[model samples]
Target: MLVKYRGSYEKVAMGLLSFIPDLKDLNNLTNEMTLYQKDESHVLYLWKNKDNDFSGVVGVEVADKYIVVRQISLIPSERGTGNSLEILDELHQLYPDQNMMGSFDTTKLVAKWTEHNRHLNTEV
Candidate 1:
């Protein structure tokens, strides 16, 4: 499940975000996290499975037409576990009335995922 990022989850959020190449710098990671923490327009979520273990992170900017995915990072161990689809699926459910979009790094990922899965009739 995707849970909203909170103060208590700062360390975990930074750890997950560091997996992204662009976010490797501690300063950059801290800055991004601060946006998610204090800005209403920016939102961050942590992916926790049924076992209550966090495996990924998804951050977005709430736009007028859609929610723009600003970043996404999954633990190396959970990279091929189909959790990306799960996280995206839950995000859609959470914002059913809006379009889904993404930032530079996440654009192709989101576009390809939706394109490849659009033909399916069921959720992931």
Candidate 2:
């Protein structure tokens, strides 16, 4: 499940976000987290596995007309297991009323994922 990020989950969120190459720097990652924490329009969601262990972090910016995906990364163990897609699916469910988009940092992956799953003709 996708859960809103909280200060208490700092370590978990950091660990998951670290999987992203661009966020490997602690300073850069923390800055990104701070934006989500302090900015009302930015959101960070931590994904919990069935065992209740945190495994992913998906960030988005709430724009006037859409939710722009800002970042997404899964725990190494969760990669290649379709967990990222599952996370995206849940994000779509949460904001079905608005168009789900991707910012520069996320557009490529989002497009590829959506393209691969276009067979469903549904949000991916």
Q: Rate the local accuracy (lDDT) of all candidates.
A: 0.87, 0.86
Tens-place lDDT digits, model 1, residues 11-95: 9999999999978999998889888988999999999976889989999888777998888899998887778878888988988
True-structure lDDT of candidate 1: 0.87
After the best TM-score superposition of candidate 1, give how far the Cα of residue 22 lies from its true spot, in angstroms: 1.3
Candidate that scores best on lDDT: 1
User: For model 2, what is the error of residue 103's alpha carbon versus the real structure, in angstroms, after optimal superposition?
Assistant: 2.2
Off by over 4 Å in 1: 122-124
Q: Compared with the true structure, what per-residue lDDT tens digits does model 2 show for residues 1-124? A: 9999889998888888899899899899889888988999999999998889998899998877789898898878888887877888898888877777888887877786677668677753
Q: In model 2, which runs have C-alpha deviations exceeding 4 angstroms?
A: 122-124
The lDDT of model 2 is 0.86
Model 1 earns a TM-score of 0.92
